[model samples]
Target: MLTSTKTGTFRFVLVAVLMLLLQACQAGEETTPAGANAGDETSTTASGTQTRSDEGGTDGRGGTLVVAMTAGNVPLPDIVPTEGSEGRRFVTYQLYDGLVRWDLSRDDATSVPRPGLAESWDISEDMMTWTFHLREGVKFHDGTDWNADAAVFGLDRILNQESEWYSASLGGAIATYTKKIDSYEKIDDYTLAIHMKEPYALLHWDLTWVRFASPDAVKTYGNDGYIQHPVGTGPFRFVSMEQGVNMILEPNTEYWGEVPKLDQLILRPMPEASSRLAALQTGEVNWAEVPPPESMEMLRQEGFQVLLNNYPHMWPIILNLQVEPWDNKLVRQAANYAIDRDGMANDLLGGAANPAVQFMYEGHDWYSEDGTTYSYDPEKAKELLAEAGYPDGFETVFVVPSSGSGNMWPLPMIEFLQQNLAEVGIDVEVEVMEWGALIQTYRPGFPPGENVGGVMVSTGSYAPMHAFDRNFASTSVPPAGNNKGLYDNQRVDELLREVQVASEEEFIPLMKELNSIVTDDAPWLFVVHDLNLRVVASNVKGVVMAQNWFIDLDTVWVE
Candidate 1:
């Protein structure tokens, strides 16, 4: 979760020098060059000696947490383009705190939204207005007071038509957020009121997208300058970012909440699952992202901890409704029925994933289990395809990402899907490209003449209704939004609009109705909802993989 312009060797050298300087100044602190080392048990720095604990964790204390992620090092994280912005959230989530944050402690059975920068909120009886009571005395990373004016500045940067974000990709990516809010008003120095154009069903979910960046920092550093030097109110303060290498984050001891236990948090972007797993195995890192499925037992046998947490990630084979046979309802239904989701969940994925029931999987209060979840009916699939005039099936590209945790193993998952589809006479040629390229190919008009319509493997969203806004809403079509399938149903669009304004009591049923309608339309081949599997050094403690896709490293301590 770190970023910067310098990459490759220069980034490495700069980090080395900074680390060396840190070591010479350490009195009892552990400052070492090998803090970023990937394959070693003993790492000695300039100041103190640091050794690996065989396999344990201890009470919260100051140490260092080195994490390897399966993502590219992004230069800057756009708060607007929350989806498919690569490693931006990984950086921003730690560097900045939102007014409302998904309760990471809640399990898959419950969605408990937590108060963040704004300690409390009030919604009007009509549900068109929301008043937020901001946390008093909160300060940005630069030691500036966090008040209504600063918060409004960040919101205006996104909402104002003349702002830089409005003229570019940020505005387009966040179209889902913009169309809902009419305007905002400052009630007091610490209170803010949000006026909605209409009743929005999930204002709390939408508020989660906002993170108040310091107005002073933005004005002083400008747009490009802010990317290099991000300032926020989170526990970790940004130090340096070396693209594709490492990001250095030092603890903000003056953080408003519980102080971060780690003295230095080093985030390394390896992008390769094998490399990330290798780093965890060698004791170079305390935590890591997705590891190779085959390495789980090996890692556990060697005293590492392999945890599979149920995350709010849904893997759907996005069906391009504008394309060939997919345009037919029967053919789309056939695509859904053709694959053995249970088999994929159990055999191919080694039971690390669950067969999906709907878009808003369990735990979300608005989640629906009433949708018609497809069963593996090979005969039905073939019969439907024959009825749709694709008796001999057709050839199409199954676009997948080469990196990231969309699927446990994207290539293997594709192979399994390929095999399953072949059983029903559908031949799939898997196109495994970079994560960024995969995202572009699906969006409406960015890549020009590319064959944008087809099957795209795996999509994830932390906010269920927001996912609908981007994927199913009328406005979310290419170039502006990520409605990859170009799926638009009059009823669905209407229900989504209603869902936005529906109160807490009215939200679930509306979402349920929407889910049933969308699944019946078959915009996507409903696949398995993935479980987020991670490998960590046994010495790593308090590292919880929240269903909201956050790795809580603040409490993580080295034994």
Candidate 2:
């Protein structure tokens, strides 16, 4: 991955894997929400998911756990997202706790919601009201009680039109859920009720991102001021956050659960894979994300642990369907057929990622064989472009983030895309941009792709509901969600809603149907499924690596 600069556009592959992780989106959902049978479901250990050190069965005690990672670019921007993207594995996840947390350890990360600030919850029968029983004695670092009132104040801020997050932002991240709240009612200090405008199937999953902030901190620090001294009720209390350096966190000794095993957790931004690996080699850091692909084998040979996990991540060549040429489905199909998805992943991503035919990764529960229709076919691309009245290829701008999670190695991905598209007479002028600013390009109106953005090159989600809602769903528009390409289909909108409300037995088949629809529509140049790889020093133990980007650092410690 290339290092972060305010603005620069060169090329590489590791696309959106880290940037758009559902784990960090931090939003919530509805129905007389089905209650998680907390008595039996609440376990310290969840198989293949985040676990306490005692539950994960790792041997380690206490020590500083220095993590070489992406920076928390913006200092405590808006814990309650207004339309923004932020990194969490480093520090935010440490400083705050949502009603529930994404179980990063699970294969089906979105399948269930793990307990966090909320001890347990029950859904009303009508699927409209969700009642949460707050964990007793959870206190923010500022000594503010975590109660129904606090939850309401924080959440209401995100929903209220007067708040900067609500007006100045396009927060499809977590607001996808918060926007559903008709209102929240306090049952008692320890109990709260969240009523939705409609029945939402993944209500709990959505709540995973609605991180509660301390009302006291907000009142004292104000929005911008709080960024300097944020407070939360998580295992790690925020000690200090320097914008581009590192976020230092110390154990929350008064934490409700067992105190973190690490004396300090340092999340430093070492953007380049080589620098991170060098840091890991020097013992300057114990763990790092997305090591240089070429060095993986060497690192492992040197006794450093390299870990790989696959989730529902895809790197698609997003096309602006609202614009001409691209509005032609045939053109879209040709673009999909022209590129060798497998070749891109194999050559550029160090074979870490898989060629994607649809939204989910291979072997995923909702994965479908039918979606694998596109393949590398330059002749086919030419024919389609000709049929669309473009006997000669067209020219357009390709916008890619300067750096992302490194799933598809975006920079190289775009260059490769430029090469393939040119063969069919298309000329692409590459533009490198930062993600925070690039996101603003996703606006409504025809030829929307021509102005602010045409191609938002990056990796995307394996999260079915959130993925559908964010990319193809009608509501998932810019200033709302990440559907920057402006792909809108009523059927897709309906299917997205259908699958969410469907029971487990009915969801897969229905989801597959939706996949077929989107595949046929060809809204994006389906690229490949991104892979997540992390390298850890030998002494680091109990590291619960979640498929989505967030990390459960509390369980990790150096020997």
Candidate 3:
């Protein structure tokens, strides 16, 4: 049995070995022309070898770049992604432009909000009213000018129920992010002001999800038609789509920002990790997301660039507070204690992850040093279960997605957890569902089933307030928001409210306190944080491995 300290040492050694392997593999190879222009800083690894180019320039820009996505089905290109974050990463992000966009041009840290369609913004003294200055001379893929009316029109599509294009599903998906916005008014053709219900401090972060589509396109095509022919002011424009197979996009030459180097971008839905790996090996795809963990070493040795970075991602079993034994905090904490996160991270995931001590990874600004840490202790787990009046243990079902987005080997990881829980007298019945279907189960309270304990899903804690509010706030339950677990504590609600209005200096301490309370409560079985991994073909150039769930493709080019 490896102790936590041993697990840390093992992870460090594993990373060192991987770095060494990468260096040796690329030693005498010809330096690939990075897509960086003159005067731009090219990034180099520890061995001083060029890895990616910053916003310098494009090396070659006429090739088609095909990427294998983890999603089983192609995401509908729309403002709201039906397939969850995976959909946003591959489809929506390429076809649409948000008010604020993630800074995906760098790989050094987690992405932060940068100006997109909106050039800059200002907030009132009370922080209730936010005015945005739209970018000039920007047009959607459809050639419609992007102005304040278009921005308000896009907002109404998801925010206003009375609007013609309002979709209950799309609106529901974005409600948590835009919950604070009470109304919007056009100050001018290129200026907009959003009036909030309160002094919401995370409005800028929320704006990243409030993407805009061409209002004329939506009206001409209607909701269903627009999905097929989505038009936005993004670097890529929708070209064609074949559901469950592939969606092709072409470069938006008139893009407001950096134009995509590739002439075409093809996103293929390949749910099976083996299929994705094979595609990368067979030259069918230049990039593959989340390759099989077991194939990492072989791929690295075979000259594939296996990129890894620490990101704000986690895979956890969110217990239903509405369910029987899971309703007890002791039972939840016991389950966390029973599982060997270190084993799962090191042995099962091949050191592609780290044990999660809190919602955010260690060293994150919001990560709490005082938070509860659940070590591998079967005895402690059994004791807690007995105290919770489940002396003989309990039987429950854990629903998990087949494959999608940041989900890292769901079946094997869950099975490993199933065995661990069984040893502590908990019988966990595994239930696997497709990624899209599993995402649908997130709404409408607890999933309908007999003795359903929880659901294993990958979630991101990119912003502390957004994460805590969407997952734990009582107001976020059901059709209102994404509190899938139905976790409602008054203190949590209060703290979330404070976070909503917390100042820059006050946010961290408040979140730390909030994290400590949630960690102690054990609302979910804390699992492992994903070390965002992907495999790119050797010929792929200028691919910045940004430390976020999403990636920027504008700079990437194929040799």
Best by TM-score: 3
Error (Å) of candidate 1 at residue 10 is 30
Q: Give the residue spans of candidate 3 off by over 4 A.
A: 1-60
What TM-score does each of the candidates earn?
Answer: 0.84, 0.85, 0.89
For candidate 1, the TM-score is 0.84
Which runs of model 2 end up more than 4 angstroms from their true locations? 1-57, 71-86, 106-111, 162-173, 405-408, 440-453, 457-464
What RMSD value applies to candidate 2? 5.7
- lDDT per residue as tens, model 3, 252-338: 999888899888999998889889999999999988988888898898899888777777789999888878888899999999999
RMSD values for the candidates in order, in angstroms, are 12.2, 5.7, 9.9
RMSD of 3: 9.9
- Give the per-residue lDDT digits (tens) of candidate 1, residues 1-559: 1223322111000111000001111222212221111111111111111112232444567778888776655435435322263354466667888777655443332233457888777667666787878888888889999999977887777777776533255555556655678899889999998888876535666666667778888788776567677888887898987766778888878888777788888877666877888788787887877687767678779978777666557777787666677789998788788888888877766666777656655544445576677889889999999999999988666666667635557666766777788889887765556665555555553243545336454565655455677778777776545676678788988887766555444555766687678777778877877777767677676765555455555666765
| Best-first order by lDDT | 3, 1, 2
Error of 3 at 510 (Å): 0.9
Predictions in order: lDDT: 0.65, 0.65, 0.77
State the displacement of the C-alpha of residue 534, model 2, in Å, after optimal TM-score superposition.
1.6
Backbone Cα, N, C clashes tallied per candidate: 6, 35, 3
lDDT, model 3, position 513:
80
Q: Give RMSD (Å) of candidate 1 vs. truth.
A: 12.2
TM-score of 3: 0.89
